[model samples]
Target: MPFAASLASAAQQAQAAAGAAGVRIETVEDPERLFAVSRLLAEVWATPPGHDPLASDVLRSLAHAGGAVHVAFGPGGMTGATAAVFGPPRGHDLYSLIAGAKQGGRGVGYALKLAQRSWALERGVATISWTFDPLVRRNAWFNLVKLGAHAAEYTPDFYGPLDDGFNTGDRTDRLTAVWHLNRLGTPAADIADRPDPDAAPGPDGLPFTARDGRSLWCRVPEDIVAVRGADPARAVAWRTAVQDVLAPALADGYAATSMTRDGWYRLTRP
Candidate 1:
């Protein structure tokens, strides 16, 4: 099936899947109109108040690639959206995971995933990566615990300053996760074989260092970023930063044999 047809078919299926959710899914073609969408998305993402939506370079990039952007419309009005870039199976490539205040729990996001799956399956794209606020356990459960993605690394201040409902006191700490779209059938079984995430870090943690004073992994991702970005006087301090980019390494054959309860995860390759 051609890519466009695949998207349309997936979208139709998604519309059916949304059954009575009063949600409609469709591809967004007007890049310029995204200014309005960006404002909504920024609000949904909880970017600080008064955020500059015009600085949305990422959205521009997606449009440039001719990526498929889907928005979910509920009876009330706009609910949410998801976007993906279709490409052949390859590393060093990524997709975005942006959801809005859609009424249904994960409905729009699920629709977007199905659409991406269709595109990926047709193009032989094996993996897809996206970033989400780590502190948001809901996203974690949905993306990693449920969808089988993992935290590869911690990106400090993924986006700088501005306004969002959730970023008031902390800079957004994000985790990058992948969806092995080419995998046949449900990925639940495959997830069973993967190791678990590390336990939460503690005060008695080991000293972690990055290139210029960032933690080796992440400590209260949102908090640390807030500290780091908040005051130049108070340098960011944490037990972990500069994580080993676990998911990619693991997907590339590395394995997590064990994770300490004290928040340390050990990985090995077979």
Candidate 2:
């Protein structure tokens, strides 16, 4: 199937899922709807009142400038939102700046992502790129395995120190996920044969520093959120370990290809 068709099919599947959960996705341009989305973002991130990441005006401007501002509504109210910014040299690419969903909205996040993909495709956008903390196992699985996005770059402290509740104590390192809007499908499933996370900092932790090799494995804590809250030192250790493994390799021309089932990032050289 062509890229657009494939994306459309994926979006259809996601829409069905959303509908089954009593959720619907819509494009928001009006100030009231956009303000609701901004509030949802702050709530999802647990951002303090004075530190709203996406102000209402910002979302309004983005919607007016041809960027996507997809809002997902569920039983209670606004359940999720996906905001993208149009830019880059190609003009056919978009950077997904922020996306989040409310608690208990099981498939709302994926649905919003599919909606964004469809929205971008209709407007001739070829790719959508976003960043996420590599240590978040669920997010890694969602972006890499479930959504079929590939990690193209790694930046240490990408956003400096994010003060949001989710990122309070940790360095803001991130893996840049390039969702080739045209590409959809699991790249590898059976290859991820590694075991689940263990306390040892070997395969269960961060992989050893990348050497001259075609492929490398990077591991993250099984539950970084819990670890960050209970053991700040361990969380910092996880941060340094991942930085040591990925920052160097990514700088040396390696791209994170996929994440394994056992919380490992598979990095490979082109």
Candidate 3:
């Protein structure tokens, strides 16, 4: 599709998605609304009282300087929020810094992402990039399968250590997702082959290895957050296992193409 037509279609799709999710998307500019976004995100991340992920003053500066701070409002109240800024100099991509939705709202996060896509396309940006924890299965599915984005890089310890409720006491290994706005499509089909258990056993007894020369399969914990809380040592082991598998594959020119709901990351070499 041509750029203009594609952008229009994306906008319409974003609108329909928000409607289906039973939410309203808005770009808030004023201080009060921006502060609301900050508070909402803080709650979403379960940050400490004085440790908001993004401060309201910083959000305001970004908004005034051509960045975006979008909030999703449902009947109850704000259900989700996302903040993004333009990429490096001379780059035509938008980098989503943070996004989160309250629990129990079906499709709220998806709708927020579609909204971000439309927002980026409208401003002549063809790509939107973000980093997500590689150990999170649901996030892998959401970004790669649901949104049709591709994992472009494997970054070990991307954020060092985070004190947020979701990320404390864990290595912040990340997969950088690059969504090609114009090429959005349906969810990816399922992969048939399973990871070979004999290839290599990780610390947690999970398999992580390349099957054949062209593809690799890595496993993630079913619920990393719960594992972190229940057994912090096991959580660290899972993190190291995934990093041992994915980091080397990505470094060797393999891209994570699709992830299964059962927690398998399928990577393919170019």
Q: Pick the candidate with the highest TM-score.
A: 3
TM-score of each: 0.59, 0.89, 0.95
Please give the clash total of every predicted structure, in order.
15, 0, 0
| Tens digits of lDDT, candidate 3, 2-102 | 77889889999999999999999998889998888899999999999989999999999998989998889999999999999999977899999999999
Ordering by lDDT: 3, 2, 1
**Taking the tens digit of each residue's C-alpha lDDT, what string does model 2 give over 1-270?**
876677678678767867866788899999988877888899999998968889999999988888879889876889999999887777688899999998888888888888888878877888888999988989988998878888868888888888887899999889998888776646653443443433445423444333233577766778888888988988888888788778888888888777767666777776
Give the better candidate number (1 or 2) by TM-score. Answer: 2
* RMSD in order of candidates: 7.8, 3.1, 1.5
Model 1: per-residue lDDT, tens digit, 1-270?
A: 665665566556655656645566666666565666677676666665566333346666786776666666667666776667754445634466465554344466665566555554555456777777654434554665445555555565677654655554455555566666533222222322334334543332533211112112322232433454555233222313323344344456543232222223333444
Could you tell which candidate, 1 or 3, scores higher by TM-score? 3
Per-candidate Cα lDDT values, in order, are 0.51, 0.80, 0.86
- Give the local distance difference test score of model 2: 0.80
The residue ranges of model 1 lying beyond 4 angstroms of the native Cα positions read 1-16, 31-33, 48-61, 86-94, 103-106, 160-162, 184-270
Residues forming the 10-long window of minimal summed lDDT in candidate 2: 203-212
